[model samples]
Target: MTQQTFIITGAFLGMLAIILGAFGAHALKKLLSVEQLKSFETGVKYQMYHAIVLLLLGFNYTFSTSTMYWCFTIGILLFSFSIYGLVISDAKGKKLKVLGPITPIGGLLFVIGWANIIINAL
Candidate 1:
């Protein structure tokens, strides 16, 4: 994606992260178990973290390649979205075992993206 696109996406995701975090803290606190709430918070944290990464990458523009951009974008989608789905599903007494495997794949992509950033910096 283009730098402008990344920036826009980052801003949107950052906004969403804040919304989700607040929702979890206020609305979900009573509905979910402690463990589930923790899981939800994890999702919010990682989403915000990568949202910042996307913003930084967008602003830097020339420092990283499309591969780095895509890794973080796709990683956030897979990792954070899967966690959100899983937590909600669990709260609803449903199991989404399929999404469990995807979270690690997303994490791997994040690692790759961070590695790429480090390499580019050097």
Candidate 2:
């Protein structure tokens, strides 16, 4: 993807994180248990964190690459969205067990993304 794509995706993801965070803090607070809420917050936090990284990479071409871009982009989708699915579904009384495994896979992508950054820096 081009730099603009990364920036736009990052901005969009950041916007979503804010919206989801507020939703969890208010609407979900009454619906989800403490553990569930915390899990949801973790998703929001990781989404926002990587979103900012994406934006930074977009602006600074020196450190950006297609591999890194895809790693973070796909990572955010898998990691954050999976957690959201699991938490919300569980709260509604139908836990999606399949999503439980997906969270870690997403996390693995995140680790790979970070590793890519380190390897590129070296």
Candidate 1 per-residue lDDT over residues 59-98, each given as its tens digit:
9898868888889889999999999999988898996989
lDDT of 2: 0.92
Model 1 bad stretches (over 4 Å): none
Q: Give the runs in model 2 whose Cα sits over 4 Å from its true position.
A: none
True lDDT of residue 22, candidate 1:
98
Clashes in candidate 1: how many?
0
lDDT of each: 0.92, 0.92
Candidate that would win on TM-score:
2
Over the stretch 8-94, how does candidate 2's per-residue lDDT look in tens digits? 989999999999999999999999999999999999999999999999988986788888888888889999999999999999999
TM-score result, candidate 1: 0.96
